[model samples]
Structure formats: structure tokens, C-alpha cells
Target chain A: MTIGIVGAGALGLYYGALLQRAGHEVRFLLRRDFDAITRNGLRVTSPNGDFHLARVLGFRETHHMGQVDLVLVGLKTFANHHLPELVAPLLGPETRILTLQNGLGNEELLAANFDAARVLGGIAFLCSNRGEPGVVHHLDQGRIRLGEFTGGLSAYADSLAATFRQAGIPCEAVADLPKARWEKLVWNIPFNGLCALTGLTTDRLLALPATRDQVRAIMEEVITAANAQELSAPITTEFAARMITLTTAMGAYRPSMMIDRAEGRPLELEAIYALPLARAAEHGVAMTRVAMLHALLEAGEA
Target chain B: MTIGIVGAGALGLYYGALLQRAGHEVRFLLRRDFDAITRNGLRVTSPNGDFHLARVLGFRETHHMGQVDLVLVGLKTFANHHLPELVAPLLGPETRILTLQNGLGNEELLAANFDAARVLGGIAFLCSNRGEPGVVHHLDQGRIRLGEFTGGLSAYADSLAATFRQAGIPCEAVADLPKARWEKLVWNIPFNGLCALTGLTTDRLLALPATRDQVRAIMEEVITAANAQELSAPITTEFAARMITLTTAMGAYRPSMMIDRAEGRPLELEAIYALPLARAAEHGVAMTRVAMLHALLEAGEA
Candidate 1:
């Protein structure tokens, strides 16, 4: 199957390289490095070693993007406002769109821009960031969970999962993807928000007893609101502890929100923290810590 | 009257120089800069002008500090741990110690280290920092509030106020000093903690609307806890707005806590934030923002 990866950032490059290595025709749509990649090729630095593709289709202009069997959307949530422009040329009659981005409301954006039948709900659990132009760094890898919002697995999703598995990337096709998405949301709103607002890494934050208790408290507020919305799962203290361990295991990888803050880039503050806080408020749950975290970020030095 | 100033940071030098200029003998107990002052002199730079005092007494050895009529304890709260060692050499039959430090529980530490009759509560509303080895930059000038910690003003308090007034330094001798201390605390815990954790200046922080609301929430929590402790003065939203205006009026001054965090000095996190949090917990008042502020400081990257 031929695949087209939109927004050739870390996640897009990782998916493109892995699928191309599995003997699938993969093309990357990038705005910045298209001319360079069209000349030299796409470069990826992974734990396995550096992988370079000498012959890959690089689309600089969206109009140059041809038909594709699948399109993996990997842009940051801030780029969602431009999704229609990005996916315009790639959406063939049978192309399925799989969005593996962080935060909520992206699927709605995609569905509004494209056909709902072509939209797939996905939760990506990978530690990846752009190392440089046309170069991607895969930090610690995790699986991607994909499902249909209408609650059924499509043949195209199974085929994509098979290709991912063959390429040594973990892929699961779940029947209920909301739980997975909400679980990731619960973990992120506390850990990423706290880390970004305080500029502390996961291990040091968890080391302080006061910070650890706050991590749990913020998560509890999220869990309470999640339970109220009937999208509840077991987001316990153990879950928070495990997340801290997992983040530490990623080896000094700063969360994307922190990275944005460190670079003075506009953060995903509203999408990740404020949206959840608003949701909690709607449910009548007191999200004191989460609200304060939003306020801190909105008032951030960056 | 002879005066001894302990922990001669900026405030101590400002007041000591003022007292000396008013024809009173003043001395500073110095450790790091005694040789410099003995070789040259103490220099004070203010908006008005710069002045030098060549006859200022500089004592490196605590044993050299004989009894004085009054002792001005103008140290940071973190340095108050050495109260017992520092106060021993300055104590006499008529000696009284006035504390002009930020934060709570310094009086308790001083009272525990000295006789109750000799310990007086005080707060300095000035903004100055150490400029050089023998110089202090008086950033902004403000009055001092001094009174008995146990209750009611005594002769020592009246004389201290008079001495400050005569030196062209404003002061108010109050019947209750703890109330004044707690009022200052409501401003410090939120603004200082937010600045320290976020590394932003006071004006920049208050300029952000969300941060302003967060600081207001913190003040409300503090006022609730203060009221729970039977203190009548409430830190209302208007009071928070007044503080925001005051902090903005001070220009781009970074909180001392941020400076300490940057230099890896032991933070007065406990004395400034944790003490009130503990009190709030004891009173069963929900200190939501204060609790989160404390958590953020504990999670500070520095």
C-alpha cells in the first residue's frame, strides 16, 4: 500500500521511514525541507542507527501531492487550523486519514475538513521531536492505538496495522479508542502541565514529596471530571507514578509544552490544560490545580 | 543611642546608614565584607544620590559586638536559623531585637532563641539588593512597622519608631505586629512564589490577565486561612489588585526567592509558603492555589 505522511515532523518522519522500510511506497509532505529532501533525501536518526532514503517523493507544494492509500496526520495541534490546506491535495477517493496527534478536538477538525468515513481516531505514544530540518530523532518508542469513532474496525486499518507491525513499530487496532485517548489526556494534563509551568523534569518533580502529592491531586481532579463525563478509567496514584517513571525512562526528554515554553513559542496551553479545565468546570468538578496551571502558563514568561 | 545591625544585607545597610547620618552611632556585623569596609568604606547608592560613610564600624568577630541599645535584625528568613549564635553577643539588660524580614515564623524562631522581652516583630517594605562588596543599592524606600509580638507597644518600640522617624526613615509603631506581618504575607506567598517558579518579573507577571486571577485566588485562599485563624483583616480581590498595582509600581524587580533559586541558595519556601499552608490545613480551610504554589516551587527547575 502507498502511504502519504503529512507535516514531516518527528512523528511523520518516523512513520514514513518505518513504513518505507517495510517495502511500502511512502511519500512525505513537508513545507520547509521539501527542496532539500527532494535533492538529498529524508534523514532519520534512530537508536538502531541513522537511516537515509535516497529516493523518496518529497512534496513541497500541496498541489504536487498525488493520490495515496493512507494519510497519517502528525502536525502539532496548533497546526490544526491549517489542516484543510494540508490535506486538500492528498485526500483521494479511498484514502483513510489517521490522526495521531496530542490533545483533543483534532479529530473534529479533521472530520470537518474531510469526510468522516476517512477519519480514524488514534493515540500515539512515542517520544519523538524534530532534531533538525529533514532529520528526526526517535527518543523512546511506544505503540500507536487506532480505532474508528463509529466503533468498527475497517479493513484499511488492519492493513495499516499489519504494515506497522512488519516495520517493527507497535500498532494496535482497538474497538474503543476514546478510553485510550482520555487516559492519555488524563496523564498529560497533570504531568506535562506541571512540568511546563515549573520547568522541572519528571524525576525531579516526583522526587519532591510536595510536587508528587500535587501531581496526584491534579490527576485526581482530572480523573474526577473524566468519571463525571462517563469516560472514566483507572487513573490512580500508581498510574501517575508509572508515568513519572516512564517519562524518566525517556532520558531527559522535555515535554513538548516545556520545549515550546523554553523556546518562547506559543504553547498548546489552552488545548491541553485549559480545555480539560473547562470540561471539568462544566461537570462541576473543582479543578483548582489544573486551573492554576492554565493561569500560570497563560502568564508565563515565554 | 548605639545600634547594632545583624545580617547586613541591603535593608540593614540602608537603615544603619540613615541612623548614622542622624548622629547615632551604628555598626554592622560583617563576615564576608569586613576587610573591604575596613580598607575602604561602606557605599550606599540611592535614587537621590550616592554617599560614602568612612567611620562605619565593621566587626567580623561576633565577640567584638558589645551590647547596644537596639539591634536591627535585617536578614533574610533563611539566615534566621543562626539567631541563637548571632544574638548571644549583642544581648544586654536593655537590648531589644527588631526583625525586618519577609515571611512568617521568623519571630517564632527569634523568640525561641532569645527572651520574649527582647524580640520585636517588624516588616520592611523596601526593595533593595546587594550591589557590590561594600555597596547596597536602595531600590525603593518605604516605612517599617514595628511592635511587640506578644501584644501592645512598649518603651523599646516607641523609642525604635522615634529613632527611625528622626533619621528621615518612616516608621509606625503598632500595638499588633502579627496582623501586619500576615497582611504582607498574603502578597508575598502568591507573587513571590509565582515569580520564583516562573522566573518572571513582578510587572510582567501582573500584566498577564490569567496570572492576575491566579494571584487573586491565592490571596483569597490566604485571607480565608487568615480569617480561620481569627485575624479580622481580609485580603480581598481589591487588595490583590492593589498589590498588583504596587508590584507593578516597583518596576521590573525580581523576587528574592527567584534569585535564591537561581543561585541554588536554600529557599525560604517553608517559612514563606509552607507555614501558612500548614496553618490553613490545621484550620480546615481549602488553600487550593497556595497548595499548588507550594507544589510548583518544590518542582522548580533550579
Candidate 2:
């Protein structure tokens, strides 16, 4: 199956290279010249040595991205405001688009921009960072879960999973995708928000017992809000704690939000932190920690 | 009467100039070549134009400041750790040392280093900043409150107030120093800590509604802690609100603690913030906002 990847970031590159290695035609709608790929092709440097894959097609815009079987949107949450312009050129008659972005409100965004039936709810568990234009540093936890939205399981997802598995990338087709999305959110909102606001890495933040407790409290608030919205996943309170422990175990890894802050860019504070608190408040759940943390971040902004 | 002015920062220079302008023999125990004084003497540019006072007797070491009548320690709180060395040359049978530093532990530290009878608690109402070394820009509110440790009044206190009044600096000699100290603490401990940790100026921080409420809650906690310690001031809850209003009324200014942080120097976190919370906990008073603010500051440190 041919695949078109939107937003040639670390995630897009990781998936693009893996699928292309599995003998699928993969193309990237890149923002800039991924010269490293144009020169030496894409490189995936992971804990399991380096995997050099060649001849991954790259496009500077969506206009050049021809018809494909699938499109994956991997842009940052703030960059998703222009989704219509990016997703329009890649949507063929039955071309499915899978969104694996962070924060809430992203799937609704994709659904609003594309046909709901042709959009898949997916979440990527890979920890990757853009080392350079065409170089991606892959860390632990590389898995992708994709499923259909309210429709029966389709052969497109199955073929994509098979292609990914053949290329040594873990892939799965879950029957329920919203739960997976919310489960990923439970970990993202709090830890990312706190790390970004405090400008500390995960281990450095958790090393301070007070901030560690704060991280735990924020996760509980997210969980409460998710449960109140009647959206939860297989991730229990125990699983959330273990996820935090995993990041703490990683040691010295800076959250992406911190990277944005260090680069003097506006953060995803509204989407990742404040919106969940607003959702919790809508359900009349007392989320004072969320409220106070929001206020602290606001104060820092001032 | 001969006087020694230690710490030669903005507060010390302003008060030293005022005392010298009032016909008191003032000697500043500062380094020999402080920039502003060395180049242009001490220039205090205020509402009444500039007063270039060149009467300050500057010394590089405490040994040159032989047996003075009053020793005014106007150093920053972090500089108070070396009080024994700074106070050595000014100690005499009749010398009274005044401390105009912020935070709670300074008085105790001074008492531990010197005789309590010679230590007078002082709170300066002046808003001054160092435009350059030895040059103090006095904005407004140049009032000073002086009170002795003992219940009995002293002639030296009255003499000091008379000198200040003659030099156009407002001052009052209050009988209850502890009350005045606690009242100042109610404002300083919270607002200063918040500004230092968040890097927000006074006007900007109090401009936000949530931050304003946080400041009010912190003041309430500090006052409650003071009452628990049996050192409550005459200021009521309404008066504390009035104090916050007054702080915002005073222009945009970052406290010394903030200046320290901007300069990448070690903060007075223990004295200004942490010790007060520890005292509140020891006194069995609930300091929710104070504790939260301290936690946020500690998180920022990490």
C-alpha cells in the first residue's frame, strides 16, 4: 500500500522510513528540504543500532503529494490549525488519514477537516526526537495503534500493520481507539505541562519529592476529568503511576514542551493543561490542583 | 554622633545621605571604590532634583569604622550570614545596630551574633534602587520605623528620628518593634517570594486577578502565622488588602530577591520564604497558600 506522511517531523519520519523499508511506497510532505535524507537518505538511530533506509520520497508541499492509500498527520498541536490545507490534497476517494498527535481536541480537528469515516483514531507510543532534518533519534517504547472510527475493521489498517511489522516496527489494530487516546492524554497533559513550566527534565523534576507529588496529583486530576467525561482506557491509576515511573527511570530526558519553552516559542499550555481542567470543571469535579497549577503557569507567563 | 553604614547598597546609600544631610557625621563602611560614589559621589535623584552629597566617609574594611554610635546593616538578607565580621568594628558599650533587611531570620541571626539590647528592629518604607554603584534612585515612600528590643524607650531612637525628619526623610519611632516587623513580614514574605520565583514585577504580578488573590491568601497566612506566634500586628484583614493595593500603587519594581535570581546568584529562599512556612508549621497554623507558593518556588529551583 502507498502511504503519504504529512508534517515530516520525527514521528512522520520514523513511520515513513519503517513502512518504506517494508516495501511500501512512502512519501513525506515536508516543510523544508530534508537534505540529510536527500543526501544519505533517512537514518533511524535507536537503541538497537542504526537502520539506514534509502529512497524515501519527499515533497515540500501537499500539492506534490499524489494519490496515496493512507495519510498520517504528525504535526504539533499548534500547527494543526492549517489541517484543511494539508489534508485536502492527500484525500483520494478512499484514502484513510490517521492522526497520532498529542493533547485533546486533535481528533475532532481531524474529523472536522476530513470525512469522519476516512479518518482513523491512532496513537503512537514511540519516543523520538528530530536529531536533524532527516535524522531521528528513537528512544524506548516504539509502538503504533490504529483503528477505525465507529466503522467495522478495514483491510487498510490490517495491511498497514502488516507492512509495519515486516519492517520490525511494532503495530496493532485496536477495536477501541478513543480509550487509547485518552490513556495517552492522562500521561501527556500533566508531566509535559509541569516540565515545560518548570523548565526541568523528567528525572530532575521527579527527583524533587514535592514536584513528583505534584506530577502525581496532576495525573489524578486528568484521570478524574477523563473518567467524568466517560472516556477512559485500559490504563488504570496503577498504570499511570508506572508510566510516570518509566519516564523518571529514563533520566535526563527533556519533555518536548520544555524544548519549545527553551526555544522561546509559545507552549501547548492551553491544549495540554488548561482544557482538561476546564473539562473537569464542566463535570463539577473539584480540580483545585489543576486550577492552581494553571494559575502558577499563568503567573509565570506574566 | 558617629555612625557606620554597612552594606552600601541602595538602601544604605539613601539613608546614609539623608543622615549626613541632617548634620550627623555619617561613615559608610563600603569598599573604597564603589562605582557611582567613586566617579560622582552619592547622587540621590528624587522629587526635589538631585542631591550630590559628598560627606559620606567610605571605608573598605570594618576595622577602619572604629567604635560608632549606630551601625545600620542595610545589606541584603543573603549577605547577613557574615554579620559577625561586618558588626565587629561597630560594637561599643553605647552603640545601637539597626537592621533594615527583609525576611524573618535576620533578627534571630543578629541576636545570635550580637547583644539583643543593641539590636533595634527596623522596617524601611522607601522604594529605592541602585541606578549604579553608590547612586540610589529614590522613588517614594521614604519612611522608616524604629523601635528598640526592650520595652523602654531610648534617647538615641528619638535623636535618629529627628535627624531623618530634618533631612526630609519620613520616620517614626514606634514602641512595638515586633508588631511592626510582623506586619512588614505579612507583605514581604509572600510578594517578594512570588516575584522572585515567577520573575514578575510588583505591578505586573498584582495586575492579574488570580495572582492578586494568591497574594492576599499568602498575606492572610502570614498574618495568621504571626498571630499564632503571638507577634501579631495592629493591621487588620482590610489593612492587608490595603497593603496589597499600596504595593501595586508603588510603580513597577522587582524585589531584591528577583534581582539576585536575574544575576544568577544564590537566593535568600530560606530566610524570606522557607523559614516563615517552617515557623507556621511549628506554630500549628494552616498556611496553605504559603506552602503552595514555597512548593512552586522549590519546583522552580529544581
Report lDDT (Cα) of residue A161, candidate 1.
Answer: 76
| DockQ (CA atoms), all models | 0.69, 0.40
TM-score of model 2's chain A, to 2 decimals?
A: 0.90
Which residue pairs in candidate 1 collide? Answer: none
Worst 10 contiguous positions by lDDT, candidate 2 chain A: A227-236
In DockQ, how does model 1 score against the reference complex? 0.69
Per-residue accuracy of model 2 over B172-260 as CA lDDT, tens digit each: 78877777777888878777777876778888778888777777877887888877776534457886888887898887887776777
| Model 1 bad stretches (over 4 Å) | A31-54, A132-135, A149-159, A230-245, A248-251, B31-36, B47-51, B232-238
True contacts kept of 1: 0.89
**Reference-based TM-score of each model:** 0.91, 0.86
lDDT of 2 by residue, A16-133 (tens): 8877877888988776546667767888888967888767687778878888888888877778778779888887898988887776676777777777778886778777778866
